[model samples]
Target: MRLTRFTDNALRCLMVLGLEPTECITVHAIAVRMNMSYEHLVKIVQRLAELGYVETVRGRHGGVRLARPAEEIRIGQLLRHTEENLTLVECFDPETNTCPIAPACALAGVLDEALTAFLDVLDRRTLADALEPRQQLVALLSRSLDPPTPSSTELAS
Candidate 1:
């Protein structure tokens, strides 16, 4: 099953935060490091903040940091929260499943099984597990230490 770019960016943001849990990092810095758009990353970060994964602070020194420990943040849980749709096939969504053979589709069952297994594997992993040997991320973030922050007008609005 393929994850949407939105979910991918969420995971990347989580990984960045996981790598440096103590320091708050700006969304612009994360966007720069991950080669993503600042605007798009802002929307993703808003969702993450709503879900309690990342905490945002406003003002000149405002930025974001992980709300919980990386080891405590399960990958599967975050994926489920970040992903709006997890259906592997059209049959997975009852409202959209128009296949005539859906009632007896063996392929749908198999896909369901595969999806379950995929999530199960992620369930066993945590953000910390994804960031083991964090030197690379540490270096990336260190270079972003002085990136521009959103202006007060931008943050206030």
Candidate 2:
């Protein structure tokens, strides 16, 4: 049950935003801190804003902030917004599927059960639960974000 990069980035962005002490955090800071391309994150922020997950403020000193509290934002809810489909197999969506073996394939049933289990677990977890691990993540990310010093070999060049 691999999540798409889009979903992954969105989740990361949300987590970063959640980590901030202030009510809002600039997109530039978020991108720089995470070492992510600012251009791509723009789209993710726009989409989340449109979905009412994050609120955006314009002009200087303005940025994005969470639309709701971390505990209030359930992981499953955001996942549904970010993901296009949960189809683990062709028969998962009847509207677009015409597989000949879909009717009686044991594989479809097994996959269906697997997907359900995966979703059920995610559905049970909230962003608040995920935030508990932030202490370690934030420390690691903060160190990684520090500007690299030129090594002796690179400086010689």
Candidate 1 structure quality by residue, lDDT tens digits, 25-137: 89998888888889999999999999999999888988999999999999999999988889888889999889999988799888888989999999999999999678976
TM-score of candidate 1 relative to the true fold: 0.86
lDDT string, candidate 2, 1-157, tens digits: 7898788888888888887735688888888877788998999999999998889998887999988887787788788899998888778888989899888889988888887787788888877687777889789779877889989999999
Q: Compute the lDDT for candidate 1.
A: 0.89
TM-score of each candidate? 0.86, 0.88
- Clash count for candidate 2 is 0
Q: What is the C-alpha lDDT of each candidate?
A: 0.89, 0.84
Q: How far is 84's C-alpha from truth in model 2 (Å)?
A: 0.8
Candidate 2: segments with Cα more than 4 A from true spot: 155-157
* Alpha-carbon RMSD of each model: 8.1, 1.9
